[model samples]
Target: MAVTDKSVLYQHGTLSLLVPGLFEGTMTIGELLQHGNSGIGTVQDFNGEMVILDGHAYQVVETGEVHELTAEQSVPFATVHFDDPKVTTHETKLTKADVEQKLLTDYPYKNVFYAVKIRGIFSHMLTRVVQKQEKPYPNLTESTKTQPKFKQENVEGTLIGYYAPELFQGVAVAGYHVHFLSNDHSIGGHVLDYTLAEGDVSIQPFASLQQHFPLEDPAFLKEDFNYAGMSTSINKAEK
Candidate 1:
């Protein structure tokens, strides 16, 4: 993979689109990697959780089974950037809340974006992967209602994701959005909660964001998005 600017975030599709059930994939995994190596997203039709780490992509299905994705695989939404952390902090025994708080307190930037990576042993990890949706797909909130959640204890893995400001809520997740992948590639999914046994938290702040839309998709072009309920649905689905 070619090196990309660590200071820039590349995103495909808007979070708002998923609010009204526009789950069709617009970009292939190969095209996504051309922009970055570490990030998070969902596969086409919200089939599974996606984690891009060390220049490779992995899909964690509803059953908590991990599979490395082929280049031809696609996604409807994703955020990626070459991860080159300028700050690395060693944290121990930190809960999910503590980690989020620390990241907020340490950086204290409300408008900019941050790429985050945490690698270590986790005492407890709670994650969920939404099931694949067929045609007449339900909105994100409804589709996630039957999501399969997984709980793992004392596992070593890495967390990959980004932090978007509240001002860009409909464009991306307003807060930390991360996914987990185990070292052995046996289990992983969208991170709901976790307790870090000990780990290194690395972060890279970015001031630039490049948003790309699926202009070729007719559904994306014609759908009347529910801007008013986007935040509400996003919050519900994310939490």
Candidate 2:
């Protein structure tokens, strides 16, 4: 049988999951979701493929295949800055498969680039069963949200600067990918790095990232820019 025809199964209580013909490991929901700030194992597709990174989400229509965490989907991402001046570099726990690496910088320096593996499940029946019985996903409304320190979007921020390589032509910097998590309501843009460049990169705050290199339109860090529910803009509801 095609993968789509099979059910997308979620864990009994947590967001972790299992899929058709892909169940061999003995990872618990807690063990699977113990990840970086991106909520790696928390992401599951209808097909049972757990997300191993923080990226876009997608779904294959021909066979009703839903993509968990992926590049094709535009999921919310973040590039958080540490408060302490000395704490420039930071890391968020992602999926288990993610391998952390430190790239060399221009002046011959090294910095850590967080490697995240997003989560996604493929069994429709799993998540359905989990949802029907437990319904334990925390009330997101009570959660604290991270946002850009500055209000307006600027073109000088590192996030935007990333798009314009010339902006950071010769600087000691380390860059990596991040996720923009959203709240119950849609607001604030979460900035993440896709690492178009490879070297000792600089990480910036939400405001600074936006100022350094701003996107035309930005989503709040809390919103899920990837693997989102069907969009309402085009009336393309999931059948």
Candidate 3:
């Protein structure tokens, strides 16, 4: 999908495919960045949590190591858009829930997509990075069971991710699906919780979401994705 409009959110692949173990990546990091500069995703085979900021991709692995991804690195699933904030708010001493509530209250278009970026010092931060999967891969929920989690205090970083409506649960995470990357590139992962010390919250709302499927991957092409528990699995694995 070609997204000339900067307001549109560009997504590659779906959580529905990831839930059932379709880990093969059809889009390269280089290609994924053409559509947006800031977003979140995972590397091929769920190797780590992917955080894109300032037009560069970083992988936060299970060992709490952060690597700047090359253009050739493969991305199984991601959501990104041009980091042009329509509204920017300065906030201090807010919890994760507080931030979410503020965004929702400020932008109450329940069915649209919202890209969020928060950069500042965090008094408390908790995150988890999924381990890379091998062949005969376990489902997303099962794989995340052994994922390594990390916590830090007074860490400085940026939170990059999106807020999708509940109606789009399978296509994307229903609520806030954010990943963190520290200023020094030392700590980062899928954010589980945090308390913002002080920061700038930027929001860009999009009326359209362009989803590109992995039509070339045999697993993505042939898998029966009509399982009854897909939503349950996504909630279990992501939240």
Whole-model lDDT values for every prediction: 0.89, 0.21, 0.90
Q: Which window of ten consecutive residues has the lowest lDDT sum in model 2?
A: 124-133
lDDT of 2 by residue, 1-239 (tens): 11211111111121111111111222333332221212222222222212222222221221223334333222111121221111233333322112123322322212222222211211111011011011222222111121122122111112211111222211111233222222111211222223221112232212122111112223221234322321221111000
Order the candidates by TM-score, highest first — what do you get?
3, 1, 2
TM-score of 1: 0.97
- Pairs clashing within candidate 1: none
| lDDT accuracy of residue 46 in candidate 2 | 21
Off by over 4 Å in 1: 1-3
Worst 10 residues of 3 by lDDT: 1-10
Worst 10 residues of 1 by lDDT: 1-10
lDDT tens string, model 3, 1-239?
Answer: 55557868999999888898887778999899999888899999889999998889999999999999999989889888988899988999999999999899887656799988999999999999999999888888888788788999999999989989988999999988999999998789999999999999998899789998887888888888876988998988899
lDDT of 1 by residue, 1-239 (tens): 34477778999998888888888989999999999988998889889999999779999988888989899999999998988897999989999899888888988666789988999999999998889999999888889888888988999999988888989999999988999999987669989999999999998899799899999999999998878878889989986
Model 3 accuracy (lDDT, Cα) = 0.90
Candidate achieving higher TM-score, 2 or 3: 3
Model 2 RMSD in angstroms = 19.8
